[model samples]
Target chain A: MKSAKAKAHTNIALIKYWGKKDPKLFLPMNSSLSLTLDAFYTETEVILDGNLEMDQFILNDEIQGEAETTKISNFLNLFRQETGILTPAKVTSQNFVPTAAGLASSASAFAALGAAMNEVSGMKADPTTLSTFVRRGSGSATRSVFGGFVEWQMGTCNEDSHAIQIDDASWDIAMVTVAVNTGKKTISSRQGMQLTVDTSPFYASWVETAATDLVDIKQAIRNQDFQQLGEITESNGMKMHGTMLGARPPFTYMEPTTIDVLAAVRQLRQQGFEAYYTMDAGPNVKVLCHLSDSEKIQMKLKEAFPNNPVIISKVGGGIELLS
Target chain B: MKSAKAKAHTNIALIKYWGKKDPKLFLPMNSSLSLTLDAFYTETEVILDGNLEMDQFILNDEIQGEAETTKISNFLNLFRQETGILTPAKVTSQNFVPTAAGLASSASAFAALGAAMNEVSGMKADPTTLSTFVRRGSGSATRSVFGGFVEWQMGTCNEDSHAIQIDDASWDIAMVTVAVNTGKKTISSRQGMQLTVDTSPFYASWVETAATDLVDIKQAIRNQDFQQLGEITESNGMKMHGTMLGARPPFTYMEPTTIDVLAAVRQLRQQGFEAYYTMDAGPNVKVLCHLSDSEKIQMKLKEAFPNNPVIISKVGGGIELLS
Candidate 1:
């Protein structure tokens, strides 16, 4: 087959995916689903070049660091070994998230990368198949392959666990992301989850209960019930943090400003605005508001927190090839 | 009425009492209550002595600090005005639990003081009356006036809200308290609660939901269902901490050692032991195990944490005058 290139965009989980049952296999403790926003996504291009010494990866216009680079390289190496491609391959990527101040952008970035790579390799693969490759890259990234509303099926094995598109999210739901990156994080999510797995008393409880919430949240999204979705996501995120609090040393990912943003969101909700927020590993605030009311909500939040500029976007589509 | 002396005790809520509608009147936003355990308790003896110039307060064998002394003296001044009592009173309190250890010993201690003072003043008052007086001293202290399974009614006015006993633990449940006083607390519960009320989005959520849980937990206790009660208390405590974590600067009462103790408790539970822990504002672990199984739970915890000594006690009764 002739060499080809494919560009794919990333996605984000409004209902965050956390807590893995098996970290080695990236088996999630619960099934988490999300949406693919048009804004704040990754654009990845895969080139099948048989002349390279080794498979190459360039993230966001820069060469990946030793540790991170090795991870991506290993993923590519494994893929190459499976395909029996004796010659190496090369991959290039660029993340369009300006400084990307949190909100699990890497999930979408890598998932998009996997989708683009699979397509360029002449593979007629579905999201689940694409997810298998992304899972080797990052667990949450597996969910980014499908657009609209997507679900990460946390199966028992690598063959079964994958991402599937749930809905197109072509409705009036709006998302506003606020970037807040102060400096280096005290602890990474990897370390936090590991600590929770090793030390938290409620880890089992979390794993047991999260599936129910995730299922309910997916149904809520399908129903386009913003209130239900928001409430469940808020509770699910808090419960995940609850497990973190029970972890040894108990590191909290929430920042003082994040609390302020959440308070503002609740205040907006109380003021008859259908607004809710979900957070990931960063200090940024992403609000799920209605498109019709987005401007007003954004203006009020902007007035209150003029220092933090909010980026507004509607429901985004799934990963696709560059025309 | 002749001048006399009497002793009293107060109860402390594991779920905190926060956001007073009226701080001076000590009107809480919601009703809170707790069990007045036998092992860690407070004793207060009050003397109606005309010889004293004013009502003097002593805690843990030391004269009250300047700020605390002022706060108490002001409360007493108000009480005396309301009671129309001419003679000055003296209050002495001894806490079985250590100071600044996150245990709400002060709550029970102060409640007992109010009861004892009322008795010595020739005011033969019921628990309701005692709760009113104690509420003025500290919102949580009023709950300590009742023995087992007490609920503090968040009364709107001075007449309606007070602590009431739901049920006396004639049942078989026991609590093993692990007192870990690493050092003086960096944040007092009062300050922490204030921060939470002012900053946390979950604060309103907690305030709205606590009453329901409070009622449900009371029912759980009445049925003598250790599993239900343990689950409810742990969840309630977690909900309470949720607000704290969402607070600005996010003060955590959870120490590393506290996590260790919690893991030990859960490990024991997994081993088919009837043990679950509920934590208040401190780093200590209060394992709510069955009275029949206290020794085994304690031994298991001791095995996990050799440095800390666990005190196992059955459901303790309310305070009484030491004859």
Candidate 2:
């Protein structure tokens, strides 16, 4: 059996993609688009052999437990049944990027693993087919297959629903991530978004509005309209979060210091700086500003929050196959 | 001069009443409505004797500072000037309600003082005039003059912006307050609401959508539909807070325990309890359920959170003049 390994990095959604329509099928409750960043990525390798007693797993250089192995095995078992490999198999994964730091690492990891597994298995399937298998593993992972500004088209089923690239962010609109305290939330994004979808009256509004906002924002990015892009991104993110606030028990990723950072950003805007901020499932803020203004804004932010290190990177390249 | 005193409790809109076409005239950005609680009420006494030295204020049995006193004294001074009073007046305010606890205490305090001042000056103006005067002090307080469920008409000018009682709490809904750790917020409602109005994009959405919710909620209360009333109140309040979340600096009144209470309430609903919650400027959670289920829900809540004591009260009566 020939083994193949492929590594990919997942992107964080500036507008935020939340709520799965079907948890089983990984169909999203709303269509979401995100920018694939180059700074953080994930890598996974897949080996196909019939001699394995049972499916073995390794995540981040460590063997996986039953919980981590189920997603991979289930997808593999389904894929094997579709192909003719009825015998048992082994799957191993290694996530190279930051683990569980509120940035999406698993999505890329699973997407790469799915692609590699398909490659080694010689399944004669396309990226979308691999994406469907990947979606079952993790919903947002399906989007990691494409690069640039990708929109996870919420399909009715595995075949129709997958991610598509909207625009290459390589030209402008840098996503500046300010590194704050890194601690995983007690409630996972899956649990939180599910609770909100089940309980919040505001959830439907977010679902309805996100489609329009995503389309408008993509257009703004294409036009290089910084103000429109900034405004739309901020509003869409806030709408996604508003559902969480209205959830059965409201929860937020906002830390006390997060407000201070926000205040500094607003102060910068008041001082004639054209910077806008969008935050995801964490306390740290991501500012969407022009590439030219990034340095000045980063300097101002550093001065305001000396403790937190700010990293500035422009639109990243698409998923690259590493040797 | 006939030294008469009349007591009035102000109304605080959970939906928020901010912005004014005419600040001096007290016109609001939107029409707001609220319910008056018997547990919290304010009493004010005013004397229009011509021998006083400027406008003096006695708040909570203590003489207020010139600056602190000026908020109320200026309104009184304006009224006195209009009524052709030659001497400076003295206004005494006794807040017989919760203070600095995000309980709309300021609204009740100012409304009561405005009513008393009007009465002492022998101005037999109707509720409309009284509300306008009270609104000249604080926007929401204008709605408190009318008992039961009052609506502050966001008229273009002083002539139209006044509070009117929409419905008496002749229904089965109960307001249960759960006290969390009480401390003054870094931002006061006056400052916070102003910030939200100036900076929040969602502010317009709140202003546009909340009025319809308020009107529908009043009808739902009149129809004695607990479910509709609870749902509307919760949605309206959430929409109001949504604006604050989108405020440039993004401020929230939610604590972790506040979220816990909300979750517990939802859990109760899932457990076959008919309960929903609404929150205001404070971290406390106020559950709106049927009067019959109040004790059962409160007991369950107490069991769930031993530290937080839930205060359950039936539909409270309007303000009564205590001589």
Top model by DockQ, which number? 2
| TM-scores of the candidates in the order shown | 0.60, 0.70
- Judge candidate 1 at residue B163 and give its lDDT: 75
Give every collision pair in model 2.
A9-A41, A21-A29, B10-B108
Candidate 2 TM-score to native: 0.70
Q: What is the lDDT of residue B61 in candidate 2?
A: 81
Q: Write the per-residue lDDT of candidate 2 for residues A2-107, one digit (tens) a residue.
A: 6777776677786677888888787888778887766666766666667876777887668888887776788777677777765455656666555665666678
Candidate 2 CAPRI level: incorrect
In terms of docking quality, model 1 is: incorrect
iRMS, model 2 (angstroms) = 5.0
The TM-scores, chain A only, for the candidates as listed are 0.92, 0.90
The per-residue C-alpha lDDT of model 2 at residue A264 equals 76
lDDT of 1 by residue, B41-150 (tens): 77776666777776677887888776876766666665566667767666677777666676666676676676666666656678787778877877777777778778
- Candidate 2: lDDT of A310? 85
Q: What is residue B160's positional error in candidate 1, in angstroms?
A: 27
